[model samples]
Target: MAVAAGCVVATLTADPSWAVQRPDPRPAAQPAQLSAPARPSNSDLEVVRLDPDPAPPGGTTTVHAFVANLGPETTASPFTITVVLPKGVTAQGPFFPTDCADLGDGHVVRCTFGPGLKEGRSATALVPVLLSPDLQLGTLTGGSVSVFSPDDRNERNNRQSFDIRVVETAAG
Candidate 1:
């Protein structure tokens, strides 16, 4: 190329800045890890509460505990549920919503839920529990069901348990 006197001519080259910036042909930022996700809320996984705080004895009753995924994205991963046995309260059988293992020796019931728990959604297992026929009518404390999750942002709300009371079955 020839430039006239007092005229300036610049050669063009393939430069990154000169290239068409069509919305950054790449993700804003790809996550490095696949297991745990970075979520905006502190509660990525949580176990909200347990139903039937006072369970009746001598009969099989359905008990449900709420597990929540408060993250920004839905995830497909199995989480563990552990129900700490209350004195005189024993599980009649394995929990419903299937695919659960009863760790008989531990006296603690464990259940696995979901390959995917949607964000802001809650799930639970309707566990069948039977109060011991001979259980003295009283409150059993420290009995809780907790959810152990992989990418839970906060661990505070992962467990919920209340005093379990064994009452006489109503004659109906």
Candidate 2:
């Protein structure tokens, strides 16, 4: 402390003849480029296309599914997944770890995962498909699936569509 004081005194006394300039405590006015920018947060959700399986007469077929989290953020809350079924296709049930419901309208099936999936993790589900009782050999179209979350970043991969053909078998 004494040495620092002596040095300060000497510096002041030596520069007495000239005016001493002190730096401004307040920051200098500068463009935004002078400051570093914050890093971008990643929150992405994706679902694979739902393919159809053969549901022959009185027999059931399973359609496998996959969901992936290719982001930097964790899904902090539960998120719902809706799989819109195509024509002539019905969701008998969804084999998933979470609570899944078949909306009975034959158009929508929903699944909710609580506490959500972590980043870089993936989940799978098996859906039981059957030919809508009245239809025989119809093309299934206009099918899609979406992951409902506010934090999703890449919308392109979030939803997908598929086409399927169901033919009536001898027993069907």
Candidate 3:
């Protein structure tokens, strides 16, 4: 503290031991380079639907939904298939994969297949469907099967429509 012209001034001086050390001017040493893991390859998936044999209006049938990898590479992630049935039709379980679930008013069914679907290999879901007893006898349209995957690159072959043919049960 100093006083000049009847005014007092206070100054501050940090001790050398209290001074912070300056960081190195050059960039710090980087960690050793590590190779990154290989990325999952893209795949092309195709969906096919096989309608069951004609059954009576009140009877049951199965829809065979098949998905194949038309890949230049094998899938490294899981994929899904969804079945949307027409009015008056419902999907029942004991489904293939055993994990298939009916969603939204019993008209839609979804099934999942895990990773490692090799190129040219395929998987299928057997969906049992029941027709309303009052459903008229004929072909029921508007039913579709679609596939989805984070790795599938082709959307053109991801979906297909199927028709359920209904016939009158023959008398014994």
RMSD (Cα, Å) of candidate 2? 11.7
Winner on TM-score between 2 and 3 is: 3
lDDT of 2 at 92: 78
TM-score of each: 0.68, 0.62, 0.75
TM-score of 3: 0.75
Which residue runs of candidate 1 sit more than 4 Å off their true CA positions? 1-43, 53-55
Which tens-of-lDDT digit does each residue in 1-26 have in candidate 1?
Answer: 44455676655446655675667666
lDDT of 1 at 12: 49
Instruction: Please list all clashing residue pairs in model 3, or write none if there are none.
Output: none
Put down candidate 2 lDDT per residue, 99-143, tens digits, no spaces. Answer: 777776856778777545789997766666766666666566787
Put down candidate 3 lDDT per residue, 25-115, tens digits, no spaces: 8875555424432356689999976777787888999889989999989998889999999888888888898999988688999999988
In Å, residue 171's CA in model 3 sits off its true spot by: 2.9
Off by over 4 Å in 3: 1-38
Question: Best candidate, lDDT-wise?
Answer: 3
Instruction: Give the CA lDDT, 0 to 100, for residue 1 in model 1.
Output: 42
